[model samples]
Target chain A: MSAESITLEELDATERFLLAIADDEFVTGQRFAEWVTVGPTMEEDNVLSSLAQDEMGHARLWYELIDHGRDLDTVGYNRRPSERRNSILLETEHTDFGDTIVINFLYDTAETLVLEAVAETADDAVGSRATKVLEEERYHLEHATQWLERLVSTDEGRRRVTASFERLLPRSADLFAFDAAVGTAPSTAGILSRPTDELRAAWRETVEETISSLPLEVSADALEAAVSEPVTNGRAGEHTDALTALLDSIHAEGLPADHPASGYHA
Target chain B: MKLEERIAAGQLIESGDELTDEYRELLCGIIQFTANSEFMGAFAESEWIPRAPSYQRKLALIAKNQDEIGHAQMQYQLAEDLGRDREQMLTSLLAGENGFGNAFHYPADEWIDIGLLAWMLDGAAMQLQHSLMKTSYGPYARIMKRVCREEEFHIRHGEHIVREYATGSREKQERLQAGVDRWWSRAVMFFGLSDSRSEKSERMDELGIKPKTNDELRQQYFDTYVPKLRNYGIDIPDENLYYDEETEQWEYTPPDWEEFNRIVTEGGPETQARLDRRRTAFEETAWVRDALEAYDGTTANRFANNITA
Candidate 1:
């Protein structure tokens, strides 16, 4: 099951999986970057900006792996929204800080579970990259969780967090809805040592446990109801208006023709 | 020895303890202003992060803004050591009761403006920061070393973007020219007014806090940038901009001092909007800070009890 034994077909599937994750990171980083100057505090602004940069860097790493003969920008920027595989949860705009925290909490928790599973994969390249990503995700999860805990301590805070969860959780189910071709191949071939379902279960359990431990009035049934439906399965290339708008906005100012083909050095 | 004597002897003022009351106030004011400039500069640039045309530009812009915030943190921390509270300074800034650099008070509407900001505005800041690297105040001077280092990258990034545009299509070249026209006067005014005009400059020079006079730094900035701009086929906006062989200086049209005064006093096009944004952010995040303070108090008390037990 070593990476050396991974067939071209299997590697192709693995590349698809990596693409989905990279798209998620890129879109999420773009969303979080909206808070650069306007975050609730200067310190929090720095924190969120740093997290955005980290996520973008992670996306760059994944993109580089699947770049083949193309450059990172070619892979990342040239693709249309319909071709992107990021979860709808990450594409949605965050108008409220509460919504941002909820998305951060849910996405980081899921990301941590998936990365942990990937880190244990038989593919050395995948495992090493996942391990590095997990190292950064540790701080991301801690930052989200700490804020989630504090945010739920007040009635107003709790209300906002609950509302965000209610609006976002259904969309988040797409985080686990991997593409059929990519999703089943790696696990079936043993390149991905852990199945995607197991990662989803772990994510669900951790999220439930963490939320329950908070002083908020969120019920177990409510959590179940929130994620019961897979709303716009982004892993299968199904997305919403948000993704299209985000892409359009990113390219509103025409793409530069003279940029470095590969990636930014510094 | 007196403060003047210490400055004359090339002694570094190592701590707040060494500062006389007047010197302490002056140093704190200067540092606070610099910190506010960093904060505002970051805020001004933040608008373009989402709109950066390329991923490379996006990453560079974010890194540059992050550096600005980091510099602001160091400056605020330095000011705090001199008896200015970080919160109070931030509040004062948001309330428009304090001033930052005039260059940041204007709006940066176009991508070309961002390029100019990184090149021209940051280049101007580099002039001042480089001079302050030998500032008599130890903490400020030490922090300037780091700030100046990062600024080197930022200025290069700016120049890279400008070069890209300068060598681009007719439209891009036009945009670069227009951006330069808009930013030229502001960039010149970035060094504050002339030496004879400001008593503060004379006091700062005497204290070794400001090594170069405003006119001298402006001349240095012009000497470096003017020829560079002409080489790129970009016109210097000022018709009167010329080099004087006799004075060994570059003489430019004097900036509108009246406008500069108004802008630094929170009368610029985007000053009110920027301040309101900061104020709104502060107000919205008040609850989070309160919760953190409460959590810290409880944790401290628990640790204290464990020791007593």
Candidate 2:
């Protein structure tokens, strides 16, 4: 049902959900952007790159909706490191475009499903915005899915992407962690419509479908363990070291008032 | 010549044609135009690398921009294969002695502008590139084929932006329409001087290296894009534009060729700023490139097959 009022509880849930998705996009998107100047080949680089901006655009959309009443630039630019919440997957950086593809594929798959679910919400504002965001995510998912398939089809591509996946899989579930700051239940909070376990299960199922062809070391029990205890809980505002550094960098424009170097000293 | 052989041929002159001073100058102009345009295009596109709205868009824009740089690098290498060194080409481009496409000189005013330029402006380039598909220069033709394939996305990207604006909120639609209106003249001028009886065109066409005249390519661009604009409910900005029934081509009031020439030759409005950005960025990233350049054997030791080795 449509929300009658912007309850603080609902706002918290909405904020949490937006942070999770936005963090995924911000981290992964910037990593992908770095490849703009450096990709293995021109064609492959160009092919993979469209994803970077798509993710960032999606982040902006989520920010707009979640922080609806606030100034966008401030929300994006001035948030503290502790206030930021992006997943570890996007924060990891490397020179290899293949690795970049692998991370994007994983994150995009997780995000597409999350956003798809969000698109069905009863709230007109959330649903309308989610619908628009989903369109861009669809494009990113296609690019990631194609590359994932291509990587798995070739023995060389398979071995490379597989190795990268194994390294990243442990941390994949961090994308769905519930934050106290953003509240708990979707009905009460306005973020997720389902329980945490349900969202985790759904996220797991989506990841399984995409990696079904690949010889991923991700077994059913491992996925269960992952759903229960993540390698990192990003949604709870816990991030990897690299992600912390990234948050600081991304939030360079929006450092908070409490920060000693917050405003206009320069 | 074998295609593989030509990919690295560096320089080519007909067997009977000795390299004369005038011939050298003609070749220089062609090389300068190709090299400067590629670099200029790269520089222009990279501006949005940091600010692209999403991860996917950021990656795509960067990759597209990278392709332009790679194309520039290849062209520079090709020029180096001729008498000019990389330094000379870089110096000339920096000094404004060389010229890139006029469209590259304009700042990407907004996200949609980038999409529009990629779509319409790059779409116009495909007309010229298609004509060079069978050019005498084997490598340039092959490169164009690869570039053209990737360019299909640019057109799609542009179309998507136009679609979003057409269907979106009035504010967004207006911003996009205004964007299209702002870009319409530049897009028209992008195909180059329409009425110029320039000797360069006659020579390039006669050489079988660049087959289409500026007018021919401009007409082709109109025929292809005008309908696309109309389909998206976009205004053409030109009431005079129409089809010639007898000639079976588009006919329109030609752009101001003199202004077109002046902007490209002297620097487009954003040229200096764009180049400065590029130069600054390159300088900022000097350590990284330097690290790669200076590496003895550590990169290989760390990641043996890291970058498609």
Q: DockQ winner among the candidates?
A: 1
For model 2, what TM-score is found for chain B? Answer: 0.83
What TM-score against the true fold does each predicted structure earn?
0.90, 0.57
Least accurate stretch of 10 residues (summed lDDT) in model 2 chain A? A257-266
Off by over 4 Å in 1: A1-11, A180-186, A189-191, A226-229, A253-266, B298-309
Query: What is the i-RMS of every prediction?
Result: 7.3, 11.3
Clash totals for all candidate models = 0, 34
DockQ of the candidate models in sequence: 0.30, 0.09
lDDT of 1 by residue, B144-211 (tens): 99999999999999999899889997877988998899998999999988778567777888888888
What would the per-residue lDDT of candidate 1 be over residues A73-110, giving only the tens digit for each residue?
66665566667889889999996888898899899988
How does each model score on lDDT?
Answer: 0.79, 0.62
Query: Candidate 2 residues B1-309, lDDT tens each?
Result: 542234235444432334445445565576567667766776676666655543345446666776676676666655565566665566567677777778887777566777788888888877877776666555556766776777787677767656766777676667667788878888889877764667866666545556677777888788888888888778877788888899898767776778788888787779888777656544543333233323433432211112220
